[model samples]
Target: MHTHTSTVTSDSPLFDADGVLLHRHPDLWFEDGSVVCRAENTLFFVHMSQLARHSVCFRDMFSIGTHSTGTEASIKSESGVDEFPDYPVITLHDSAEDVGNLFTALYDGPNFGNNDPLDFRVVSGVLRLSTKYIIDGLREKAIVHLSQAWPTTLKGWDTREDTARSFEMKTGSSSGHMYPSPIAVINLAREVDAPTLLPSAFYDLCRYTYSQIFEPSEDDPLYVPLTYSNASPAASPGPHSGPMQLSLSDTQRLCLGKESALHAITGLIQSMSHSQSIRNSGVQLQSAFSFSHPLAQNPAHSAIIPHASNHHNPYHIHFSNHRRSSSNLICVSAAACRKDFSELVELATQHYVFDRERGFSDPLYVADELGQLKSAEFSNSDAPECKACARSLELWAARERERIWRMVPVWFRLSMDVGAERTASPPVVDIN
Candidate 1:
């Protein structure tokens, strides 16, 4: 067999050096393979035809000459007597595990089993190498797997959250373990030019406390395993093995996005309990509840305080003066509805909605909690919110959550295209 002989330029001992060893990829090596590809310390004996068929980069390279100018080395045959041809070794500038994963996907197909946390390594490896090699099919598949965690649309986001919540309930651990770390996800998204993944990643990362994001402690809840064990053979040390950090620019964007998310929750609270709305109902609703806290006494806390000294109700005055008919007022029992609204506002404020220390500043979680106020379990009052008032608040909170989802890209300073594609419903992906 004709052989391509060339010198190895790696820092390690020369290929022919005594006692030097190279690991052959367990799955990718084929006896009849026509070419060799080396990534870091591992070598893959794979057929050139399959790679050429799927990757434009490989096709173009093979057309010219496969690794003609790169490192070349010979290996002993099974008998250790005859030597295999010194196949041209295409030195890939990627990690061995990543190359192994890429070849596995190329041969066995990307198995993203149930989009499990461990699947992230495979997905990311395939994504990185596939994009580099211009393997569009693998790249697209990897993205589908990623989308299972970092969804684009609000509905998809909710589904992802529900799955995570369920996982947490089952495992008694932080739901963060259900998916790969968002810091790693963000970095991979940037590396692969997949901006669509950023908003969801950023939003997920926002759930962590500022210290957790910036300086995670050794016993950080984000790293703790519940039921999921990383010791499984399928699990390898990956980006989640340690505190992966965002780039300085990404860090800045994350900070801005986090602050914006906090403000979004505050904005929702303010909108739901605006001063004008409070003043209109305060005098009548004041009979329902009184402020015991000093901060609640200040009118400046209108976002949480519903009591206002203003006696005039513009809608009532408008009706009393015969300027508008009573039918013009949409709320039939303004006092009762307003009373319920104030109690709900107070309930939300008292919760961890604004407490970064408690790591409950996530707008989605806060909004969901608000939505559940219509349910009996989350209601603190003697009576649940009136059907009309509760339903209105629930619907408005749902819409507001969607609006916040849409604004995530804007918050992170991502391009409008990121938000545009994400606004639509997520397309179904078969991950079998």
Candidate 2:
């Protein structure tokens, strides 16, 4: 699903247009290079036989008109692209970076060996170009990694922390730092017939703020850079600045998914809050409020809670002390803890430190929140808290996390788990 931009050369021309029959990128020119792969203004020096061996498309394309007699050769007549008399120039419709990366992956020895580039852009480029150019094996590898990030089973989902995952960024930008663009992931999943990936991808996408969804800042993970293309060096690129644009339906799907996820989480919180054991336990302690905390307990109000996101489309949650609190602090057990449904959700949200713009409806945030119940240090000498209650809450969170994980496909309105997908019945005997 790569959006190709028709390359337009700078009006100044590459060294006097007439003198230059073709422009070769010095960065990619190889001494033994046989073929020239052109995408936008970028050109890559590569071997034809190597490309032909891996991609049936390249094989079939190269196989066409192999013996064109003397001087005649197949060349693209598109503007700004000049066919040269030297090596064969195979013009393509994808971005230069994508084409370059695809060829890099193809030519690179060991097939995903050491020092191989596997960032969001590179993997995405490999996925799209491999599928398009019919490169063997790369597509499946890309799919496997993506599937690992967004598994089809609760087992895979629950054991995500244990898995050799690389979805998060080192800088810690929450929803914005580590993962690929949610919209891009969703679109690519649809394009590749990967329905199993939709649930997690959609859920992750729903966590982005409206601005992050559209115009992600330079600091945000979704922010796309201006790629070097034929459309002048000064021209900006990437999803928001260039050819990649979302359809109306894409917007609706994301909004709907976010809204649904919010409702489900809210319901789960309410249900967890009303447990009979949670209400009756009598424990008193000082408020866990601090200046650094956005929403902390206040003496004026009976309770302290964050403002729930607006209930309209493009909705998001915010932590505002001015908000009328929907949650109250109460001891879950006699462990001297006073935090109710709202408070629990709030604590969990804080643990993950989700994007302020999008709030915390993310499934990942929920898992982290639950994990914190057992691990969070509450027994400070000044604010001495309960470890027993923490352990109990941790167990409950584990159970709830499992339940939520199972219902992911359902929440996205999919029926993948029905029928034979659940089990393999013994083969019926035809002897009767």
Output the number of the lDDT-best candidate.
1
* Candidate 2, position 187, lDDT: 65
Tens digits of lDDT, candidate 1, 1-432: 545432332222324223346667777877777777766667777898898889877776777763333213444333332133455556676778788888888888888766665677667878877877788888888898888788887667777877888999999977777887787778778777787888898888887887777666655644533333222122233434445667889889888888888887777666666421423353343211122222223344223211222332111111122112211323435565566667767777766454844654688767767665645532655653445444345444555565677688888888653634311122121110
Q: In model 1, which runs have C-alpha deviations exceeding 4 angstroms?
A: 1-19, 66-72, 76-82, 224-242, 275-333, 353-359, 377-385, 416-432
Give the clashing residue pairs of candidate 2, or none: 330-338, 330-339
Encode model 2's per-residue lDDT on 120-228: one tens digit a residue: 5566667666777665488778767666656765545534433323433443435244445555666665554556677776666676666766776777655666552
Per-model TM-score on C-alpha atoms:
0.73, 0.59
Give the Å shift of residue 58 in candidate 1: 1.0
Q: What C-alpha lDDT does candidate 1 achieve relative to the native structure?
A: 0.62
Candidates in order have lDDT scores of 0.62, 0.50
- In model 2, the runs with Cα more than 4 Å from the true position are 1-21, 25-36, 41-45, 65-89, 110-118, 146-175, 215-219, 225-245, 278-359, 367-390, 413-432
TM-score of 1: 0.73
Residue pairs with colliding backbones in model 1 are: none
